[model samples]
Target: MSEPDVSKVLRLFKEEVKVINVGLEYFYKELRKQGVNAAHVIWQPKPELEKDLEDILKKIL
Candidate 1:
């Protein structure tokens, strides 16, 4: 496939691009402080027997 236009991608960055922070709440907060549209997904280790979280991660990945 052909490469995407870098200029177009850079133009999008000039606008508000919503960010989904999978971890590190502080990083999300810092983005907001800079007037960025950001959201956080609180992540933590679940019990070893838990499979639901792993399934969700698979879908996202």
Candidate 2:
């Protein structure tokens, strides 16, 4: 494998970093602490899935 062009890597490094933090708020907090643009999105299991798998989950739990 060959190394990437240095100029391209440098341009990417200069660009602003934006993140979509899904599921976990911890990652978003860490990113904010580092002066990164971070957005948080709530993630959870779909209600339909819970309804469909309730029987199996009950048995397992």
Best by lDDT: 2
lDDT of 2 by residue, 1-61 (tens): 9977799779879998788999888998999999998899989877675565898888899
lDDT of each: 0.85, 0.86
Candidate 2, residue 42: how far the Cα is off, in Å: 1.0
Model 1, residue 60: what's the lDDT? 100
Where is model 1 more than 4 Å wrong at Cα? Answer: 1-15, 50-61
Q: How does residue 20 of candidate 1 score in lDDT?
A: 91
TM-score of each: 0.52, 0.54
Clashing pairs in 2: none
Question: What is the alpha-carbon lDDT of model 1 when measured against the actual structure?
Answer: 0.85
lDDT of 1 by residue, 1-61 (tens): 9987799789887976888998888999999899888779999986584588888878899
Candidate 1 clash total?
A: 0
